[model samples]
Target: MTDHPRSGAHDRLVTSLGTSIVTGELPPDSDVDPVALESQFGVSRTAVREALRVLSAKGLVGARPRRGTFVAPREQWALLDPDVLRWRFADRVDGVFLDELGEVRLTVEPTAARLAASRRTDRDLADLEDALAAMRSAGEKDADEQVTADLAFHDALLRAAHNELLLQMSVVIEVGLRLRDQFVHGALTTESADKHAEVLLAVRKQRPKAAETAMRALIEKSIADVEIAKKAI
Candidate 1:
């Protein structure tokens, strides 16, 4: 646990450094000057050290016996950690990263949708409908709201699956989905509500095959949408 009194400073320092490392502002294997960090972030030495500890736990940095702490290789990063994923999505839109995220979604979501259709409870259905309603209400007029609602719909879908492992995986998946949604927000030429509705309809009807198919199509559209958005960027 961190010092309660210095929590704010600790958090700020961690955020700044984490974002820099993930965005390549502080590229892999670069030296990390803790004394410089204390000066730059205007935090106590203790706060700086504590922040470094947090990043270390996230696999963002490591110390050499003679050389002090340095940014770790990119492959060493805890990519599934929510904070790391958030930092990666904080700035810069990389098409390759988005494609990889889509591939992950393809691997996870269709199977989740199939299970949800087979096992969803009344409460799960209610939550999904509520999320879908919010999505419809937001439409294209409100990009931020649409993104939030879209995320909620997926979260509810995962919950509907009623599997502990998939639920755990949703933590990472949600972050990637938000990035994709935000990236394609204003650039999307087609209405996404209908596609989401198709998946919802299948789940509601307890059609596993249909739900799986609809989810696959939805994810495919998202992949294509990201590609289109990248071109506009």
Candidate 2:
């Protein structure tokens, strides 16, 4: 119970302030006064400092030589950190980003699906099925959870292709998922889910063109959704 309170205090301070920091409430070059944060979060300086240390480890902040702590540049941010990803989603989610994601998906994911069709191992298929099942179950869940499952499926399929070059695109895919986390749930029709299932079927059947076609349908739908969202906004 004592540890739980301490843990909860630390997490609340970090989660609230981390979003503010990364979303530019505390912009780059902005000083982070530990006392101010402690006051604002109604916690001790020790707790606030510990929260800042977590951010510092992730390269979101840096301590200057006797000056103070300041926010780090976007390039220094921990892209893979779950907090950073959420902050990014909260910070800037524009149609241009989604459009770029759709373009990349059209160019990359379909072909990866085709290659997986030809090269996937039994283990790969088993992993793919697991991810698909997870995704299906997550469809009833939040967009964030669904995107995590959806990404696992595509990432596994890419790895299944056995192409080192394709594997490098994992970061790009992760970034795309982060960008699409909201737009996907908002725009995805039930038909979109079925379309993805068709792509999986094509991959399972070892039909390259079919795999490509089905994947293109999925990306094309995403592109349309991006365009529609742009017009609405």
Candidate number achieving the greatest lDDT relative to the actual structure: 1
Off by over 4 Å in 1: 1-6, 187-190
Highest TM-score among the candidates is held by which one? 1
For every model shown, what is its TM-score relative to the native structure? 0.90, 0.71
RMSD of each: 2.2, 5.2
Q: Tens digit of lDDT per residue, candidate 1, span 99-180?
A: 8978988999999999999999999999999988898887677878777788889999999999988887787777776677
Candidate models: Cα lDDT each: 0.87, 0.76
lDDT of model number 1: 0.87
Q: Tens digit of lDDT per residue, candidate 2, span 3-97? A: 32357889988788778877778788788888888887788878987888888877888888898888888789886576676665675785665
How many backbone clashes does every candidate have? 0, 0
For model 2, the superposed segments whose C-alpha errors exceed 4 Å read: 1-6, 91-93, 103-108, 123-186, 207-213
Any residue pairs clashing in model 1, and if so which?
A: none
